[model samples]
Target chain A: MYKLSISDKAFNVLNYGFLSFVLALTFYPLIYVLSASISDPAAVSSGNMWLWPVDITFEGYRKVFENNAIWTGYRNTIFYTVLGTLLHLCILLPCAWALSRKELMAKKAILWVILFTMLFNGGLIPTYLVIKSLGMLNTVWAIVVPNVVGAWAILVARAFFQQNVPDQLVEAAKIDGASDFHIFFKMVIPLSAPIIAVMALFHAVGLWNQYFNALIYLTDQDMYPLQIILREILILQEVGGDSAAGAVGQTENLLEQAKTAELIKYAVIIVSALPLLIVYPFLQRFFVKGVLIGSVKE
Target chain B: MELSRVQVPSTVRRETRFHKIKKRFLKSWQLYVFLLPALLYFIIYHYVPMYGVQIAFKDYFVTQGVWGSPWVGFDHFLRFFDSYYFWRLLINTLLINLYQLALFPLPIILALSINELRLGVFKKWSQTITYAPHFISVVVVVGMIVAFLDPQNGLINNIIVAVGGEPIDFLTSPVWFKHIFVWSGVWQQLGWGAIIYLAALAGVNPELHEAAKVDGATRLQRIWHVNIPAILPTIIVLLILNMGNFMAIGFEKVLLMQNSLNLSSSSVIQTFVYKSGLLEGQYSFAAAIGLFDSMINIILLVTMNQLAKKTSDNSLW
Candidate 1:
């Protein structure tokens, strides 16, 4: 049905070539990492591993699993993500609902206050002090509480509520003697599922990958989340063959440690990321649609 | 309108206190109850910490707590302003962030170009490949960069040797630090960032393109007249938001990538604060620097928002 001129064909060819080049550039490192993680340590050291594994081994993964700290980190990370997401939704949904309604008294002032923090925060130290003062230091709550509801998520949810929940529906519900709370719970939330799912995914992935808060707040190594633990493992493994690595570890096999660290990095990434990635494809269709609905009006 | 106006004054005057309170409660109880959790969180997490910002003007001692911390007004601020590293940190932070802002739109361009492709399977494959790297953790991304740029056995060096060129120490060299950081960041983020642009592009009206085609406008002309103009608002909005955070570089990635040799170029305000506050526990000094950093961000956000409003009537406000 479509016909292209010579110049148009050339343009298309050029664009395709550029796209492919960019794709390769983006993907090459990931492939390199994956290949290196699986390759034999000796082969990896000799620079033989490239796009594929030199000697495939599950030993690296075995070593990662054998470490007691890794499992603790995983458990803590999971706990944080689940609790954080729940707290996030609990705070964000109702706030968005209230903000979406135009007739709410002091709405303008509330909005200004919320948006003010979005542009300006007291930064890390003060926030840390507040968390410390609240007696959340070294506790799971330290990681979960302060960042439970991001301003961006609130804005997105607010936009979703405003756009999707029609005033006429609420008015009709009111006329029918239904309370405002009932209308929101029964009608608005049912319609707001797609956006909620998107927000949940966003927040969950963020919490899963989060390490900075854990690093700053939790002094105990046992309380470390997966990312921080993985960082420790990675740094230790990278330098383990050298005399300097001895400071961080007394592991017998330096090569093995390096191999395990590389694999563990991949494993940590896969484990932490796989849940969201698995959930993402199913939500991908909804994502573009939801973001459009939420953002376009704003 | 006249009847309502007359009734409003009478109703206000005639209503008993009990009835007024009841009515007020009835009207707003749902909103207030619904907003409770978020309000509590804002008060506890955001607002309470906001009060702690006073520590920036004091010598905050953890033992004495925020209130009891002795006031040394403007001393920490003066220290930050007068420090030898202040200009370097400010300039480096600004330069890196500006570089990011300047180069941020390449992904959008890439998305636009990719969306325009006629090849179906190729397009799908390219998009999938491009988006895959975005999901990788920043730590892993930096690790990959280090491995590829390793002077001894890195893939890049191997390639250079194969091509008869000298191997370069990309990560350690201060000259190459910013370029590597920015380009690697771009590489990782381009596809993910392009997603919003692609979404905007999808919203473009096909009928406009058809109409332009009927008018004998070429694809380039049609894109110029139709597509670019359609996504201009989104582009402007994103640009304004990007400008708002023109100093907040990701501390984790920079921290991961930093080595002793590259410390001069890599140590931004975030890393500086992380070291001074979290690692060294100079809470007051770090708070002052952070407060100054946030002040710049606020000023930039306000200025950009105002400019966006003035020029295009599209702003965060």
Candidate 2:
């Protein structure tokens, strides 16, 4: 073992110290939001909330839950995520698998076309115009289909297939008189569980975080996703939605409404992210693996 | 001559190539069939937009349609290029990018720091907390920012006031805009970005570190000599990609954070394009600006890739 000199000990102390700060820095904002969410509206508005809740209250939670728009947003987001992830996987996996096959003719040529898009996009307006021309605006397919072919995902999934699913297995299946389709369905798809999970999680999380698509394509309030609705409460201060339905009967005062609106943003922040945070720890390992697969080609 | 007699005809050559292609296609028809859906998707969703890019040159009118629209040549592009807004938007974007690029090495440093921690529990906990914020929605993240920075009641302002400093309106001020934008971004992405470098670090040869230790090198020296070199390829590639994407800032978070007070600093090419093309309905003009932006990006990416290839033999291409 190497002897620790004074400078070495100093370096060790600084390293741990900086990392501790990083832990606190990353963690504190989230804690602040959580504390603000439960704190009394008066306390929140007065900046009394800190490391923990001040005058603990669920006024924010109550407001977030009662809102019909939020429920609609939640439902629409779920609909988008599930269907979109499925559609993404359906289009992505088979293509990736095919590309992974060394025998697949002109793989490089096909990948070149895909990679070309990543290098040079037609920019936002032209894409929107294309969507408009397709009459996909204000529709679910507008958000889902337009975002289906991510070049990174395709490459990652291709690399994953190539790495994980051995070519020998396909050859063995072929020797057993299994057709290409049978081998793909029976052998390849089953082995694809990890990549599938990774893709699904990524696509689902993307859909969950999605609002820009809704902002552009869908104008209907009914079609808005949770993030969009959350944006409204957070930035726009549009409180005609359900979250304020409870705050209604008690007070019509401007001061009271302002406090409610302030409280609601914190609540909305927590409520909006609660699902991902709840699910993420269990899926953390998978996420790290997925990210590595996406980023590191080898 | 015998040599001339052995030479194949051009038609024979072409026909053999065609037959070879046909045979290959027939053999791998199933793979092609599997790829058809993705290809169709790329054609419809990706290529079609590229085709729509020509409307940037055309005097695009919704009623006339893309085909029927008059060919205005570079009028829209010229209009954008000539406008005073062009310089402002470009400068603002470049400055922000430069600022961000300056901070890009933080994640690499962070990963190195995390790797140095002998305490396993703290290391795992540190990583978990740092990584947790990435999964949060932009709305929630921005919302958290708004809450934490709220002038009257925000935690930041409260802390500032407690320490006897004036509670500056961090969001609205143009001076604070880049700092808030970049630092918040760093906070959000620090851990997630570290993952790639950490993954790279994991591949560092243990023998090299052992040799360094045997040579009585310090911990920091080992990291500098062994760990950094091992991850240099990954870092260079990421740097090249980041430089290539200099103009392509995340429009969502910026749009959310933007206010009229901070508009001078916050306005970038994408936001400007969104305003004109989507909101104000100057589709052709917006498309022209967008087209110019993408052209710059492609040039940058190609140039950077070529440079990296020449210098380090590590390029995206």
Candidate 3:
């Protein structure tokens, strides 16, 4: 039923043209990186390749696999992501449910305590000291335990519960002689599937992308996450690696190192991010609903 | 509703201690059980470290632990206050945050513009493209930037040569560091950030647009009058939250982007804490700085919340 004005048609054309241009600008560099990573090291250094790859080879990936540290980083990162997400969900879901309930004694006080942390905190050093005092430093717990309950995730889940789960449902369950736990399990949680999916996706993406915690707490190179390893590789390249500074007999070739580093950076990014990216399309409906629910009051 | 059926005993008996404990536990068991995991997390991760805050007031030795570390009584704070790099870090942090504040409205504008577009497919495609980059890791994002901006053979520099201008070293320059960081962040985040605004726009009444169209109001005029006002509350709330978090820039991107040449501009509170606390083992001092930074953020949050409450009814509380 909609009709486009002549000017509107022109405008639409112009908008699409502009959008395509912007999209190309946004994506080209990423494409270039992917292509360059697979390109021959000599060709990449000589500036022969741009827009498309030249002398394509899997040598970079091969070298990256040979580095024991990269695999160690992957192992450590996956462990943290999985353990952290589970711990986060376990803490967040019940706390959010409890906070949403009005009848609980000291509910207001508890909510305030939780909200206080959201607003203010002792900074990194204080947090680190606490971890150290707990004897978690240089351990996997140090990386996973501290950030297990993100306030934003809690807030989102709470809002979802408040909006979607009617009090009547809980009351009906209670009337049927259901305990609070039974009511929550039977009535509240099943209705909150969308929000939980959104939370899981958000938390998973965050854990996968995280590097700062690992960088701070874990000192063992064997315990390093992928991002930290990538960082070391990048820094090594910037400083011309160990070989360029007249260090003798470092078996790794500089060109080969650069190629591998470049490929590994892209590959790690793809690997770390691919799960969330794939998960997002299917969860898009729920994500949009969750965001809408959370932001509606604002 | 079910609680109405319970008959209360009129006799207020001073019960036995065991009975009292049992009754209290029965009433509050669900609350305590619900709270237990979060409380455990708080104790292990939050409160236990709170004791470590004393190290900021002490000369901490790793072997001595928190209790054994001798108190220096504000010595680290004084040292930081007198340090030559204090002003540099403070100013750089404030300036970069200020730049981010200035840029905060851009995504909203983009969202509004996209919403105004009549073509659905084009708008959807545009949104998808813009939001795609946000998912890319900061490491890869920075890598893309470096490759593109490389003076020797980068696509950007190659274009510069075509235009007869010499290639500029964007990454290494201190002047360009904040711009690169903020703008790239904006580019990556604009679509994702626009989501809230789009939701707000969707909530706007269709009849208002129809009425405006009948009144001969231009598309821009209708958007300015109707759409903008509808989303104003969200805008204000988001603004308050953004201002509150102004100091807490994500350290990852900045850390990834920093080279020795640009460290002068890029070394914020977070990176400083990471280096000093974890690497150099000055846990107490780093904690002090981190505590100071968080205090500033808390002050900003409280002040902004109060201001929003006064100026408008919208507030986080």
Candidate 4:
């Protein structure tokens, strides 16, 4: 390696120092949330808890797990995520693969039809009206069906197929009298695992974090996703402030309710976000690959 | 057989055209079949609602349906334009978007800084930590924001009080609304946004950097000359993409952060539409506003794309 001058050495030190600051800025809140969740509620509210837990307790976690709403939301979210992602992939992959084919007839028209949705849409009310008209309001289909395919995902998958799946493979399979379905299922699907995995991960995470759709469509508490429930506990509390305690009647004493609310907010945030955060480092490469694939011009 | 070979040219052409279509269909019918479900989905969910957009011009009622509703062309739009809040909504929307657009260079700066670092555990760990927030849900992010900015006993307030200062209500005040919204968004997205730039930087030809080093350039000089120029195209493309969604300002997060206290700044077109159309059941009025918002969005996107095409060789199209 070339020898660094004193200025270059100083630059290195400054760069490292700047990056360390950025790391702390990003990690501090997350760490604070984690720390606050376990710290005694009184300690947290008294401003005694800052960087680390003080007088740690499991009270917050206990409250979160004991709440039926949290469990319901968790179960509902899992169901929606699994079902929605499966449906998303099932519809997306096949359509994207077909669009990628040069031999496919009316391909331009089909691709244009999909692409138009990206530019202009009916907006919110009309979409909600359509969902209501279909009698899908407050149903699983409302969550899983309406948003299965994105034009961006299709473009990404189509680009992947065009780049990675050699045309000669399809031609060879055709020559062997293998059907298109056979080629798609047996050959293309296996060969396109990277794209599929990336797409699935993206779709799954989207479904997991879904909030707006659930908020708009479902009114039934039983059907509410984790985000909606989280909104109720985390956001609604702030909206109503301390006065909402008497309205909900979950606890009698206003002060105790306030303390518990503060405690559970941090825990709930961790509960809702921790799974994805913990899994992120492992799947970071696929996430990077997905973004790179997306940035490639269609 | 000889007579058949001497068939009329028109007849022969017609038969061949028919046969060609049939042959093509036979070869790739499965591909069309594979595309059907997605086509159906777009038709029902997207295209159908596009058709339903006519409610913007009609007095839409649940009983009458979209077709049967009486035509009242542009009345709702007229009301929205003439309303007290029109300019405020428009300005709020534009201001928040402009604020975000102004910060677009930050991620590029970050990526450049990261690229300057030597490969090691520190660099890797910093990268990992920075990208972690992008994975957090908007609900939780906003929750954290509200919690941190809570006037009493919140972390930020705690720090202020420790320094012998008064706790400021960050969320409720209109003055702090845009700052909190934009800065928090920057915080969440900075590293994630830099990923694309980093990817672009990784593709930069290493020989250019080597040659710069041989020419006695300092590290900062090389970064300025070599790296920034290398990632210019990626930056342009991302800028155009940003312009495409200029009107869409994270409606969910805004809605979460919003209260009656900050409605003056937070009542963007989308939230307004949600309130009028869904909550208050003024479907026609809200649809008109929604339509107006989208029209402006498309116009801005096209204009920016054109501008980019003319100035740089980069355009979203």
Candidate 5:
């Protein structure tokens, strides 16, 4: 074997050093947030805690749990994620499957029409107007129905179908007297677990992280998602529900409330982001595959 | 009959092709049945909006409806072009996108560096750490920014004081708005974006690397000559895709990061559309702006695609 050059060795050292720097930069904020969430509110605000928890306490989490609106937002977000993802799959998967089939009528025309939407959409106001005209304003339907089928999702799922599900398999199943529905339900769905998982995860993460839709559509506080509530607590600084009930004593009390609010902001960030971040690494491979699949032109 | 079959006319060929289509259509009825809901969904959600975009040309009222509204031709468009915030919004939007585009080479660099790492737990760990931020919601990310940049008692400010420097309020500063928006986006999406190039790099032929090594090329040289060229097409395609979305910046994050103090820098076309249309109840005007934005995006996409086709042979089409 050829010996490594001194320059190559030096390059390797620098490369590893740069990557390590990136890793640390990305990781430090997450650890800081996690640390600050459990730290005492005053200790956190006073800059005593940076990398690790200082004066550790569960007060921030307690306040977050105590908030009625947070729980409502949590429940509403869960409902939207579940309902929206299911509807998304129901509409997207079968449509993708149908489009993937060589036998489908007007396939080119249908695909072109769908693909055109990706290049040029009606923009925000008109879509919002359509939703308004449909009388879906201020309701759950407004959140779930509008984005049930994505063109990129269709392309990704369709690519997976075309690559994995062979025409011969369907033909054999048909020859054996299996109907199209039977083949799809029994054969195609089983073979498509990986793509289905990818699609489901992507859609679920989208719905879970969705706040803009809810912000615009749903005016009612009870229908607010967790992200929306987090916005109120974190950005808007409107965490004035039951948590502020004890802020009765004047300037010092108000100061104490603001400190606690800062603490809750950290905890809220951790709490809202914890689920997806925890699940993402384990399912990271499938997510990568989904992106790769989308990038590969048919 | 035999002579006629040998010299079949175009009409007869079309009729027989129609028959073939009919037979296949009859056989695949279930496919159509399965596609019906999606078809209806597209019609209502997507196509109807395209139809409703006509209100951009009309003086739309809820009472008049989209079609019933009187046509004002180019009044709203003219009003937008002549408006004071028009240039600000246009420049801010393009500047942010151009800033993002300037950093487009970053993920490719990350992917190359990450690709150079020996396959092991350390490599995996680094990727995992970098990718975790992508999973964080925009609200939480913005929340973190707000908290970390808080003037009096933020982490960054505290650090600044530790270093004996003035505390800089990042969120409120107009100068800092675009940098904050773009950098936070880069931080969030860097690892995620690198995944595509990583995928491309994985497909680079191993033999090319061996050949480069046999020629006594250094590691960096091999990476530059072999790997970079291999992924050039992928890079071009992705760059073209990014250009295609030039005007369609992440409205959600910008909107979240926006405030009165930083409105000069943060108020993009998309956020402007949302405010004027939804919040301020100027549906017709906002639709006009939205329509203009979409038109620019389409033009950029098509133009970029054409350019890519001519130069690189890597057009999305």
Candidate 6:
């Protein structure tokens, strides 16, 4: 039977106390936002909605879903994430597969080139110019194509292939007169389901959160993703100020826009974030493994 | 030692090495075929952009192609160096990275505290909650920060007024901007950053702790001697890895957080480039600034890596 000393007990109490404190501190802000989204706009604006909903109303959520631009942004974001991740896998998986091979010619040189680009890029302006030159700006291809290579993703996938897919399997396939391409496509890809899923999820989440590229590349509002449009709405609210709330007119005026915008900010936050958050717990197990594998090489 | 050299003739050695390389290439050309798409991607996207970096030295025009553009050697670079915003951009970029580096060990501390727990719900919940914020978008994070820091109606202000203190508008205040940005970053990244150290700490042999217990070492002593040393290499590697991004301050978040009132402190190199190049269409000037930023990062990374190697005798190489 083991018994903790006074010092150990003190440490345990302190540790548990700090952990709980952080748990509350990190979680309470999110709860407040969720509660505010469901509360009356006036209640939220007055800072009355704290830990729970005040004068519960679904007005904010209703307006957000009804907005055509927001809906289009959602559609665009989904398409980008799906198509972007597929392109990522098509480029990344094979690169990883080939690089992981001990027999691949110029492997060291190839890896050096990849790693060199990883550390130093041509900077944002040059990259943007290159994309613009390719006539990809404002197109869906701009959102997905130039984003084909993620250096870290390729490195992680390569590391996974090296560690998990054994040399013995490749050699066995070779002895059976199977080509290197056949071995990688048939044996390697199937055996690497966990890594593939992890890579896909990681890439998809990144693409879903993407707005910076769109901010620069795409000029049209209809082409805007959810994050960008939401940001614009947020910026509009700030610029509109208290006048937006006080001013009323015959049209859908500044006052109405202000109230709806305030509510919609919270609703948009929840809507954009909900899918990833819901999938996170299930992906948590894979991510832990994925991150650990990636970091260990560094 | 001479007998162990296998007595191969020098002429035959070259032939064998050549033959071995040829055999491997003949057996593996199919893998090269697999590599073509990725190779083309790198050439088109990455290498082509790299080629375009030469535009920083030229008076670029859409009418004239890259090679046809007249070169004004170092004009853009000189202009950037002499620009009024140069020092401010440089300092702001450095300070943000400095704070990030200073705060690097915090996640390790969080992990250490969590590891101290024998096992409990607190451990599970703390891990889950801390990591959740990392997934939130930058725009939402800035929105939350603005809402929470609103001078008249924010929660913090409400608490301040309740306690008979003055409410401060944190987001708009220049003094408060860096703190808000840095601490919020800590909040978001704490768990994700700790994952590697936690993995390392978990890999520590339990027998070492048991041995320390038998030797009458206290809990603090055990953690300090055992856990700290175990994760030290990981900590250094991550530090070096982070230093590699010394110039990259996640332009997205800073861009989101920047307002007219807080532009003095919030306008980093990245934002500067975005504003100048993307918004104002001064492509050459922005590219020059961007090129300078990359150079600074590379230098810092190399220096830090050297220092890390000298101090700890560990390196990425």
lDDT of each: 0.77, 0.84, 0.73, 0.88, 0.88, 0.82
lDDT of 3 by residue, B193-290 (tens): 88889888988999998998778666667778999999988998998889888788867788788889988999888778778888888888888888
Put down candidate 6 lDDT per residue, A166-255, tens digits, no spaces. 888888888999987688778998999999999988888888887788888899877888878777666555312223344567355755
Question: How badly does each model clash, as a count of residue pairs?
Answer: 0, 3, 1, 0, 0, 0
Q: Any runs in candidate 6 off by more than 4 Å, and if so which?
A: A238-252, B1-26
**Which regions in candidate 4 have their CA more than 4 angstroms from the true location?**
A238-257, B1-15
- True-contact fraction per candidate equals 0.49, 0.76, 0.44, 0.78, 0.78, 0.68
| Model 1 pairs whose backbones collide | none
Candidate order by decreasing TM-score:
5, 4, 2, 6, 1, 3
Clashing pairs in 6: none
Off by over 4 Å in 1: A236-279, B1-22, B118-120, B164-167
Write the residue-wise lDDT of candidate 1 on A41-122 in tens digits. Answer: 5566556776898889766666556667777888888899999999898889999999898878667777777777787787
TM-score of 4: 0.95
Model 6 C-alpha lDDT per residue in residues B93-178, reported as the tens digit of each score: 88988988899888999999888876777677677778888888887788788778878777889888878999898877878888
TM-score of chain A of 4: 0.93
Candidate 3's residue-wise lDDT over A143-185, tens digit each? 8788788656667777777878899877787777788787777
Residue A295 in model 1: lDDT? 63
Docking category of candidate 1: acceptable
* Cα error, candidate 4, residue B94 (Å): 0.4
- Model 2: clashing residue pairs? A63-A243, A67-A242, A67-A243
TM-scores for every candidate against the unseen true structure: 0.90, 0.94, 0.88, 0.95, 0.95, 0.93
Candidate 3 chain A: worst-modelled 10 consecutive residues by lDDT: A237-246
